[model samples]
Target chain A: MTLVTVDDVRGAATRIASDVIRTPLLPCARLSDELGLRVLIKPESLQNTGSFKVRGALNTLLTWKENGTLPEGVVGFSAGNHAAAVAFAGQRLGVKAIIAMPHDAVESKVINVRRYGGEIVPTDDLLGTTEELASRYGYPPLLPFNLPEVIAGQGTVGLEIAEDAPEAAAVIVPVGGGGLISGIGAAVTALAPSMRVIGVEPEISNALSLAMTHGEVRELPRAERTIADGLAAPRAGNHTLENALAYVDEMAVVSENAIGEAWADLADSAKLIVEPAAAVGLAALRTGAVSLPAGCTVVLVVSGGNADLVKLAQARMG
Target chain B: MTLVTVDDVRGAATRIASDVIRTPLLPCARLSDELGLRVLIKPESLQNTGSFKVRGALNTLLTWKENGTLPEGVVGFSAGNHAAAVAFAGQRLGVKAIIAMPHDAVESKVINVRRYGGEIVPTDDLLGTTEELASRYGYPPLLPFNLPEVIAGQGTVGLEIAEDAPEAAAVIVPVGGGGLISGIGAAVTALAPSMRVIGVEPEISNALSLAMTHGEVRELPRAERTIADGLAAPRAGNHTLENALAYVDEMAVVSENAIGEAWADLADSAKLIVEPAAAVGLAALRTGAVSLPAGCTVVLVVSGGNADLVKLAQARMG
Candidate 1:
C-alpha cells in the first residue's frame, strides 16, 4: 500500500503552489473571546474552484502529465465541488473531462462544472455510470479521495496549518469520504505530533466514525440524508481508513440543527458564508462534542463554501 | 488645504500593515469568462472588522498616537461597519470608544460593534447626538469619512489595487460618503494615470453623482430608503467632492433590483456574501450601467460584508 508521507505533502505544496491559492488563516476574534480558546480559521472555501478539491484534482492531473501517461480524457463522479475541480483542472491541463453526477445534484454545481468545460453525464447511479464511461471511453478514472496522489495533495492543508499555527493544541477537520481528515491527520501527526487531530461528520453520515469503531473500512447499512451533502459519503475509502487509524486522535459527530446554528454563527460573527459541510468542525466545537484544554489555540479547517443560496439563507435563519 | 498625497497613503499602509489584513485580489473566473473582461475582486469584506473601514480607523488612531494628541476617549457616529472599526481600533489602541448609532440599525452590526468593546449610545440623530456627547465629555470625535487623515487612510486601497493590477483599464468602487472612491482616485491616478476610476451608488442615494454634475458638494432633497443601508449617507463630504472632481472619471447609479441580483450572483458564483452597498459596483457592471471596453482588466473593490441574514436570503431569492 502506498501511504501519503510528510514529504509527499511538501512536494505537492511545491507542485501546486502556482495553481492553487494559499488561502488565508484568519483569527476569529469574537469566537476566541467567547470560547476562551484562540480560534484560527483556514478558509479553503476561498480556494480556486471554491474548495480544497482543486488541490487534489490539480495534483493528480499534474502527476499524470509529468509521467507522460496523461490520458486523452478523465472521468469522475461527484455531487459538486470535486466535479468542478476535476473539470477546471482538466481544462487548464489541456485534457478533456466527462463528469458523472446525480440528476438531483445542486443546480449551481452543475453549472460550475459546465462552466469549466466539463461534459456532464447525469445518472441515477453516479459511481456505476462513471466507471462504465471510463471503461467505454478508455479514460482514466479520478476517484475523489481514494487515491494516493489525491490524499497527499489534500494533506497540504495540514502542512499549512502546522506552519501557520504551530502552537495550536487541537485541529478540527470536517470529514467527507474521509479524504480530508486522513490527509490532515497524516500531515499534522508528522509535523506536530503532540497536537490533537479530530474529525467531524454529520450524525446521519458517520462513515469515518463507524469505520474507526469497526477497525476497517465498511459501508453503512443505509445511505442517510444530510444537509451537508458533501459529507454524505456512504463508505470510507480503504486508503483513507489506513491513514486515519495511524494518525487521527479522535472523531466526533454533530446534528443537522447544530450544523445550521454553527453556519449562522460563522455568517454573522466571522462574516463568512461557508457550506453546511464546512461548518461541521465549528458545529463539533460549538456543541461541545469535541473538547480541548481551556485557552488552547485551536484551528478549524473550513473545507468548502458551496451551497444553494436558499439553503444558506435557511441555515442562517436557524 | 492639506490634500491627500501618494506619500500619505504609503505612510498609512506602513502604519497599519501589522494590524490590518492585506486582503486578496482574487480573479473572478466565471465573471471574466462571461463578461469577456478580466475581472479582479478585492474582497475588503474579509478585512479586519469585516470592512475597509478599519484601514482608515486605524490610520486615524495611529496618527493621533504619533502626534501625542491621542485622547483617552473617542466618539464617533456610524450606522454599521465604521462603528465596529472604531470600536476595534479603540480597544487595540487602549482608548475608550463611544459610538452613537440609530436605534434602527442592523442587529448584527450593533452586536459586532459591542463585540469590539465599543459602548453603543442609541440615538435618533446619529451625527447630532455623537457631536453633543463628544463636546459634553470633552472627547475627540473621529469623523467617519470627511477628514484629510481619513481620506488618506482610505487611499491605501487604491495603492493595493494599482500594485496588484497595474494593467487594469478601469476600477469600480462603491460610493457611500465618497471617502473610499476619493482615496482610490488619488492613489490610482498617482500610480496608474491611464486607469479610469468610476464610482457607483444606489439610484436613490446618488449624492456623489449629483455633486459631480453640479461641480460641488450637495445634499439630497430628502433621505431615500434603500436596501443598501451603508450608502444612505445624506450628502457627499466636501473634501471627497474635491478629490472626485480631480481624479474620478465618471459616476454611475444602480437600482435596488440590480443591487439584489448582483448580491445573488456574488453569493452563488463568487461565494461571497457581501452587503448591498458592496454589491453596487457589481450591480453597475451586471446591468451595464457603467460600461467598460471589452477585454480590459477591471477591478471591483468589494467594500463590506455586513447584512441581515433574512435580507440576504431574500436578495438571493430575487
Candidate 2:
C-alpha cells in the first residue's frame, strides 16, 4: 500500500504554495489563560474559500493540469467547503466544474460555489448525483477526501503546524471524512514524532472514533443530526482509516451543545467566527473531553469559517 | 508643526515587529467584482488584541521602556480597542494599567481589557475619570488617539498597505478621533504619493469629516447613535486635524444603516467577522458615498473586530 509520505506533503506544499494561504498560527491568549496551556490556533478559516479544503482541491487540479489530463469539466460532491474549493480551483485553472452539494447545505456555501463559476447541482443524494454527472459528461471526479493526492495536499497543513509550533505537545484537528487528520497525522508523525495528533468529531458523527476503537473502518447506522454539519460524514474512508491507525494518537467526541458553545467562545474570546465543524477541536478542549498536561502547548486547527450568518446569529443569541 | 513621517512609521514597524501582528492584506473578491475594481482589505481586525490599536500602544510602551521613563502604571480612556491595546501593551511591558471605559462600552471589550491584566474603571465620563485617576496615582496617561507616538505607530499600517498593494489607487480608512487616518494619510502620501488617502466617518459622528470641511478642528454638537460604536468619538483631536489637513485628500460619511449592512456583508462574503466601525470604509464604498475610477485598485483598512457578539448576532439576524 503506497501511503502519503512527508515528502509527498512537501511536494504538495510547493505545488499549492501560490494557490493557498499560509494562514497565521495565532496565540489564543484568553484560551491559554483559561487552559493553563499555551494555546495556538491555526486559522485555516481565513484561507481562501474559508477552509483548508482549498489546499487539497488546488493541488489536485494543478496536478491534473500539469499532467495534461485535465478534463473539460470536473465533478465533485461536498456538504459545502470542498465544493467551494473545487469551484475556486476550477475557476483559477480555467477548468469547468460541476459541484453537487447537499440540498440542505448552507446558503452562503452554495452561493460561494456558484460565485466561483462552478455550476451547482443541489441534490438529496450528493454522491449519487456527482457520480451520475461525472459518468454522463465523462468529467473527472474530484474526490473530497479519499484520494492520496488530496490527503497529501492536506498534509501541508501539518508541515506548517510542525514548523510554526515546533514545541507543540499536542495538535487537535477536527475530523470529517478523516482526510484532514489522516494527512496531518502522517506529516506530524514523520516531522514531529513526539507530538500527539488528536482528532475530534461531533458525538453524533463519531465515525473516525468508532473506527479506531474497532480497529477497522466502521459506518454509522444512519446519518445523525449534528450541529457540526461538516463532520457529519457517515464513515471514514479506507485510506484514512489505515493512516489513522498508524499515525493518529487518539480520538475525542464532543456534544452538539459543546460544539455550539465552543463556536460562540471562539467568536467572543478569539474574535474568530467559525462554523460548528471548525470549533469541534476547541469544543473537545472546552468540555474537558480532551486534556493535556499543564504548561504543554496545544495547537487547534480551526478548519473553516463558512457558516450561515443567520445560524451563527441564532447560535450567539442562544 | 512636526508630524509623523514615513521614517517614523518605518521605525515603529521595526520596534513593534516582535510585538504586533503583521496582518495580512487580503483581496475582497466579491466586492472587487461588484465594483469592477480591485478591492483589497487590510485586516487589522486580525491583529493582536483584535485591532490595529495594538500597533500604536505597543510602539508607545516600547518607546517609554527604552527611554527609561516607563511609568510604574499607565492610564487610558477608550470606548474599547485602544483600552485593550493599552492593557495588552502594559501587561507585556510589565507596567500596571488602569483603563477607564465608557459604562456602556461593549462587554467583550471591557472583558478583554481586564483579561490583559488592566484594571477596568467603568465610568459615565471616561475622559474625566481617566485623567483624575492618572493624576491621583502619577500614572502616565496613554491618550487613545492624540499622541504623536501613537499616530506614528498606527502609520505602520500605511507602510504595509503601500508595500502590499503598491498599485492601490485609493485607500479608505475609518476615522474616529482621527489618529489612524492622520498616520495613514501621512505615510501613504510619503510612500505612494499618487494614492488618494480617504477618511470615512459615520454620519452621526462625522468629527473628522466636519473638521476637514471647516479646514480646522471641529466638534460634533453631540455624539449621535450609530451601530459603529468604535467611531462614536465626539470630536477630532488638534494633532489629528493638523495631519489630516496636510495629507488627507477627501472625507466621506456613511449612514448607520449602511454600516450595519456592510458589517453583515463582510461576514457573509469575506467570512470576516468585524465590528461596524471596521466596516465603515466598506460601507462608504457600498453606499456609493465614496467612488473610485473604474478598474482602479482600492484598499480598505478594516480597523478592528472587538464587537459585542450579541449585537453582531442580532445584526446578522436582521
Q: Best candidate, DockQ-wise?
A: 1
TM-scores, chain A, per candidate: 0.97, 0.97
**C-alpha DockQ for predicted model 2:** 0.44
Worst 10 residues of 2 chain A by lDDT: A308-317
- Model 2 clashing residue pairs (backbone): none
Error in Å for residue B130 of model 1: 3.6
Candidate 2 lDDT over B95-132, as tens digits, reads 99898888888887887788788898989888789889
**lDDT per prediction?**
0.86, 0.86
Cα RMSD of all models vs. native, in order, equals 2.9, 2.9
> Least accurate stretch of 10 residues (summed lDDT) in model 2 chain B?
B264-273
Q: Write the per-residue lDDT of candidate 2 for residues A23-137, one digit (tens) a residue.
A: 7787866788788998888988878888899999988988887888887889999988999999999999888889898888988788778878889998988778988999999
Model 2 alpha-carbon drift over 4 Å, by segment:
A94-96, A192-195, B14-18, B93-96, B117-123, B131-140, B162-167, B192-195, B293-297
Interface RMSD of 2: 2.4
